[model samples]
Target: MERVPLSVLDLATVRAGHSSTDALLGTIAVARAADDLGYRRFWVAEHHNMPAVASTNPPVLIASVAAQTRTIRVGSGGVMLPNHMPFVVAEQFAMLEALHPGRIDLGIGRAPGTDQMTAAALRGVSPYLTVEQFPDHLRAVLALLGDDRIDAGPTARLRATPAPESFPEVWMLGSSTYGAQVAAALGLPFCYAYHFAMGSDVDRALELYRSGFQPSPRFPEPYPMVSASVIAAATTEEAIYLAGPSRVMVQSLRTGRLGPIVSPEEAADLDPELPGTQYAGTAEEVVAGLDDLIERTGARELMLAGTVYDPATRQDTLARIAKAWGM
Candidate 1:
């Protein structure tokens, strides 16, 4: 099988004993490690009003990561477009691309990155702020970035200022066929969120993306990527041990009790049988599992999202995965 590109999706999780500042620093360290290890991209996730997640503003975090890493691409694993204005999103990423040049990507998602209450607070009580409006919002963002004239009465010819020499590579992020269809129709790269929500029919979604894809000026062909949770260590026991915290953290989020991610020692008491999306084992085992996932999804790139509590452990896991993949 051909080797697939490896990337990272970091949420900047705040560990139990650490501050949000520590988590941000950890994100930079992880990005640097991933860059040195030959990872293709380091993408930060946008999560709002979540105590455990510190990456509320993806563009700012992407800028910081881009400044710290030289070779690896830096961008948002996804910036949830529903939470902010389309023009602002376009302008922020335009600035990032202006500073980082060819190393920036603009991955946009339709969902709100927070709870319903927080989402309402972020978007305000606007009747037009519905998921159905994502396509329009996305189009507006693209127009601003591409310097295309808009049809709005007052902002007809408005363009996002400080536009880079080149636009950041745009990607449509989704966990369902809706996103696939939109991305395909728009001819942008699509990223499937298998790490968080693995929809029942991922293959069908991919098929829809490929079948409906139309050649665009920016993207000539379909490019699909999948993000999955990975936890690999030198030993199977150690891998499982390190993954405990992530398991607990996921459960907390799912149960609507968002809090700081606990230490592995603290997580040991949680139910061992609680289901999780993570793949945890030795390097060889993890590689096999990830290979199977890639094969099943037909993804050209794999973005690993591991929420290990310790920064050092997280970096070590990424290094181990890189070595196993022979990157």
Candidate 2:
């Protein structure tokens, strides 16, 4: 069968309480496995101080994961741009592009990637980085990466050697309409955070993006990618069981209950059952959801993220979903 290009988002494991080092190493293994399985992209999320997530440093992790795999594309599900200096981002990603060549992606977001306290820790005395500065930061980063300035930095002097003859593909990651607008204005590919937000007006968001899409030096046309929260298993019941912890986590975010990630078993026991859930189902059901999503979002590419708990099981779930989607 021909391969359907599917990308993965690694927060990386959903197993509530493992050590960060272990989870990080495990995600590398999973990426290697997914690469071997012909997965399209393996992207890591930028989450700060989240006890449940191990991918705090996307660039470092991207390098590690990229070093461990071949063929599969690796990039950030997002690097919260508001937290870092754009030139630094350009330099780091340029390094990854140099090393990996033709296999790196740079998906960016406007949010701080954490709550106030955690944000303070990362930024420390720096003025709060808000959404307003996002566009400027984005422009600056791209300029450093692609612009031919008179006095370019050392890296920029040579168009940053090994620059793939092109920089990494830049994407805007959003959970709301503003992000859609920004991505559209830049004409770059947009990836929605349907995985967590389970947004109510998905269609409206897409409409905004397509309608506002303006060609930039970065994106010349409208290209959209979507990421979703999918839990696939042999059966609906099994998947739900696996999704227990994550469901609780989502509900926690939805309801303002915050802090550490709970184990799947703990979540299943504590939360009982989720109400009005969005991403829980069997392979067949999830495939149906993806089809509905494609029509509703008008997405050119779709990536299912936060899909499974265990590394091995995650691969199995993707394999099954790929078959079901006829990809």
Q: Give the winner by TM-score.
A: 1
Across residues 1-327, which tens digit of lDDT does each residue of candidate 2 receive? 232356888886435555777778878987987787677899999987665677888999999999999899999989998778777788889999988888999999988888778766676634365456677778777667785432344434434333556678888888889889987876778888877777456677888999999886656778777778777888888887777766677676677766555666777678745543366678889888877877777777778776345676677777788678665
* Candidate 1 wrongly placed segments (more than 4 Å): 126-128, 147-156
Clashes of 2: 1
Off by over 4 Å in 2: 1-4, 14-17, 126-130, 147-164, 216-219, 251-261, 275-277
Candidate 2: lDDT over CA atoms? 0.76
| Candidate closest to the true structure, highest lDDT | 1
How well does each candidate superpose onto the true structure, as a TM-score? 0.95, 0.88
Report lDDT per candidate: 0.86, 0.76
Residues 153-272, model 1: lDDT tens digits: 344576776957988888999999999999998889999998878645789999999999998887789999998888888889888888888778768876778899888888887744
Clashes of each: 0, 1
